[model samples]
Target: MSQELKTKAHLIYINGEWSGADLDELEVVNPANGQVIGCVPNAGEVEAHEAIEAAHQAFQTWSQTTAYERAGYLKKFHALILEHQEELAQIMTKEMGKPINESRGEVASAASFLEWYAEEGKRVYGETIPTHTQNKRLQVWKKPVGVVAAITPWNFPAAMLTRKMGPALAAGCTIVIKPSGDSPLTAIKMVELSEQAGFPKGVINLVTGSSSKIGKAIMENDKVRKVTFTGSTEVGKMLIQQSAHQVKRLSLELGGHAPVIILNDANIDAAVEGVVASAFRNAGQTCVCANRIYVQSGVHEEFVDKFTKAVNLLKVGNGAEETVTVGPLINQASVQKVRHHVEDALAKGATLLTGGVSLENDGGNFYAPTVLSDVTASMVVMHEETFGPVAPIQKVETIEEAIALANDTPYGLAAYVFTESVSQGTRLIEQLQYGIVGWNDGVPSATQAPFGGMKESGFGREGGHEGIESYLESQYVSMGIN
Candidate 1:
């Protein structure tokens, strides 16, 4: 199966069949070694429309299927995912450069979404409305939103796609997906599994290639009732503008510069562990990663020392190696961005404690896991989302100062706080302005939790009950009796 997947002529999936095999292909390179492992068809605007039309046609029958039937299909797909977990993880690590262990975890997390939404599909209930007049009967009905367009990022390729696909399918909505050009192989393979799971033709469609062309086609199509996207804020905003004319309902999970606060009363070891896990996971490519670290002045020195030492222990190399905790950046552009942030911080008087150099060699895109101290708000790393394994620590004198600094940014995707005091934790949770909060817990995301953001982080939730709700619409019914 692994050999077949690697050698397969991956193509655009539309109307439940593989196609576009003759089109110009886009090479899929391994970020760890810079080898072209595979190539997918470079679909354009015309192909995007064809996928949309397929989804629209399938919705007529798919949306009418009983929720039980939808759940069954989702469950079958979930089982197939588990069955092929190892192969899926390998493909992900080869194409995207996350450690093999993390890639396996991502596959498990992705499978959970299918199992979860399978159950949630059965629970998409409606309510009876209370009427003022006895002669009139009123009710509220829940329904699938219609054909959906899902635009996902490359970070957690499998998880991101399943997160959107699970709910959209279980809600009885047909979907057209546009996976990131950098990592479409995983998406293509999943779509293959969906076919094996017995999903009806056109119920799930995937197109790869130029992002702008495919994105424009998906957004501008009138048949597409909703758009669900997870990517940069700039791209999300552009999608919003493109879909404006059609007034499409959109669920956007955009950018975030999540902040972590460590108070003097917190367990220094525990705080370090949580921050290291949250900040450096996936080589810090996650949206909710600990971008900024704020430590109270009383314990700032101890915290920085422990954190820097912990970071130094991480082994950075090709993700295929089992011992490597930190992998290369997805591409050279990402490496350059990480380098720029580190350079700018050092120039601004921020002290680098460890790991500030690049590990690029023989086409490898590696950067060292770095830590910076004495960072201030003026530094670019402090304000911008450094989507790399770099942690910048700042010392704050009081809880008020810490909260103020954390909330100062426009992004409100996620924030973490480490404190032993119940009062302090409560206060920080209430005062922090973000969609998701972690109280002494860095890895806070779960398949059953409401995951999203506020302010510039973008609106809409992607997990738990809210995830399915995003693909549904409510209709009020009225009846009159003689």
Candidate 2:
């Protein structure tokens, strides 16, 4: 693994060649123990433009390839991801601080996107319209949009890239990806596999370094016809505004403050299990994890008791450790943010049920899996996406109140409800006002399902059949026949 990291480390891939070996190096730190794992070139605006140029040039030929040919390349890429899954998982654990098991799961999820898109590329269907005049024929064809600029987040480094890259490439479009600097190693490794998969030169490129300069450069480039981003709402808004100048296509999967509601007729045991799994996965760093949990007054006390015990069982330590379930936050800023949210909740009269403080002597950015009760709607934790392991739960008197509280947020990414009554579940699902809803399940996202948000959570879907459509443009053709 060390040799693998050194082989491509400190280099930026451009036009199918590795450069920036001597550029200003930025250290990649292991959040687990504050160790410098390796260094990568701090590429800036210049490299970003170069990558865009390369992708633009490649798109001319790459977009001409048949859907079967494009699917072939995607299939190879998917296989390479699974073949090198172990190394990729290790790098992710080192750089991003998710547990080894979770990292492995992410790797699998990442590969699944490529595999699904490989077959889905061939399924991009066109439409035919019957004309009023028998002599005229009209049809619609789907074509590649153009060069795509993908900006991915560090939380699910591998999965986020493949989710965007798979659809873009499968649609016969070239891509220039800018992975988060905090977790660029995993992205670099994935790009390396792309090269080995025999993707044509400039078909796929990656640059790492200052996000601000690269983002600005990509937005300013006329060749980049589409920009896809997954991050905070503030940054997504900026990208949306930047796209207006070129009328560039945009797909933004921004911030989420997901809510989980447990009704009076809910299965308390299953509800507790579901919440624990969803809330603590990736240490609650995921955008869809349950941040605000609401339970009906009839079963609030019992649910809280069981939920606290489940949260306490989560092992917190370095991700490299086999037994550790929860790892450190990506950096100190994340740690501070989590701490601030917890403190604010407590100051606002929320009760700390199990864990609230950072774990001492852990030698890493580890926080105890915390559960809070008596939480109110006005608390900061209720309003903001904590992006940590702290679960702030409130009690609601009725189903109507639970639904109201869940939908009060500006985000409409995901929501969950636990109820044994099928009629009640159906009614709640219809009125949830979220892009994705889980009735009795905590984790509802799958590779085949359309995953995205509404409202402030941003627009566009990433999975199912809708994933590949974002990278394609529809061309209407009208013909006069004798």
Cα miss at 290, model 2 (Å)?
A: 0.4
Clashes in predicted model 1: 0
lDDT of 1 by residue, 65-109 (tens): 999999999999999999999989999998898999999999999
lDDT of 2 by residue, 1-482 (tens): 25235756458888999999777988888887777888889999999999999999999999999989999999999999999999999999999899999999999999999999999999999999989899999999999999999999999999999999999999999999999988999999999999999999999999999999999999999999999999999999999888999999999999999999899999999999999889999889999999999999999999999999888889998887889888988887888899999999999999998888887634677788999999998899999999999899999998889888899989999998999999999998899889999888989989999999999999999999999999999999998999
**Each prediction's whole-model lDDT (CA):** 0.92, 0.92
Tell me the lDDT of candidate 1: 0.92
